[model samples]
Target: MLNLKNYLCCLLLGVVFASPIFAQVPVQKNTFSGGITVTNNGISLLPTFTLGKPAAIFDFAVKSKRWSFEPQLRFSLEGKPWSFVFWGRYKVIDD
Candidate 1:
């Protein structure tokens, strides 16, 4: 009888502690969708590749309630094969 009482108490405590997890509600938030950027690197003061040519950049962004991801690709409008850049951002604190 003592063993049965202890088992019931443990089960009750476990259910109480785990109930919140099953009742969670998801959050929704606003986020940026897409953007565009145009840049010229031909006349850069610092020595670099591309030799100062105009390029068109396209960007796409995807975001969750607590996380954001952005991927960008760049190509020379003048038919020069340049480089591709990939990046992402994560939210640590909300105000």
Candidate 2:
């Protein structure tokens, strides 16, 4: 009967330690996403490629809780920097 008692105690300890694995976390925390784009002359009314020099653009964003920061950077193909833009945002209303 000693073996049976030891087995029951081990099972109880395992269940107590593993309970937190079943919990759920909020969806709007510690999120990161980004993209790389290659184009010419930025966004234009007419999407013509042959009219200007080629460029590469980088965009990325990081979000945590109710705040987020996004940045956009651009550069030409010949190693010339073009522009930089930063967006800082906060959630005022929740849907």
Candidate 3:
């Protein structure tokens, strides 16, 4: 259902407020930010995902860190909804 999809997106957005991994474990702090976005992937045709929209995205990354996590937030379209992605990275090579 459309409502269900929206709810899932909302949940992702809300829960993604945690600190990122690269922030703590990094050779250098990378504060990378980009412009606003809308309708990245065209899954909009699906009747069940009518409300499928996207917003802007931000990515912050660090390298050579251990036990770190990077949290990502992406939108479906303009004012549509947001999804949360949590990633943890460990440095295998110290170099």
Judging by TM-score against the true structure, name the best candidate: 2
Note the residue pairs that clash in candidate 2: none
Q: Across residues 1-95, which tens digit of lDDT does each residue of candidate 3 receive? A: 99999999989876785456335653564443334334445333245544443345554444333445566556554544455556778777665
Off by over 4 Å in 1: 1-32, 42-51, 79-81
Query: Which residue pairs in candidate 1 have backbone atoms (N, alpha carbon, C) closer than 3 angstroms, thus clashing?
Result: 41-52, 42-51, 42-52, 42-53
Sort all candidates by TM-score, best to worst. Answer: 2, 1, 3
Better of 1 and 3 by lDDT: 1
**Candidate 3 overall lDDT versus native:** 0.54
Off by over 4 Å in 2: 1-28, 44-52
For candidate 1, the lDDT comes to: 0.71
RMSD (Å) per prediction: 8.6, 6.1, 26.7
Residue 87 of model 1, lDDT score: 72
lDDT at residue 49 of model 1 (Cα atoms): 47
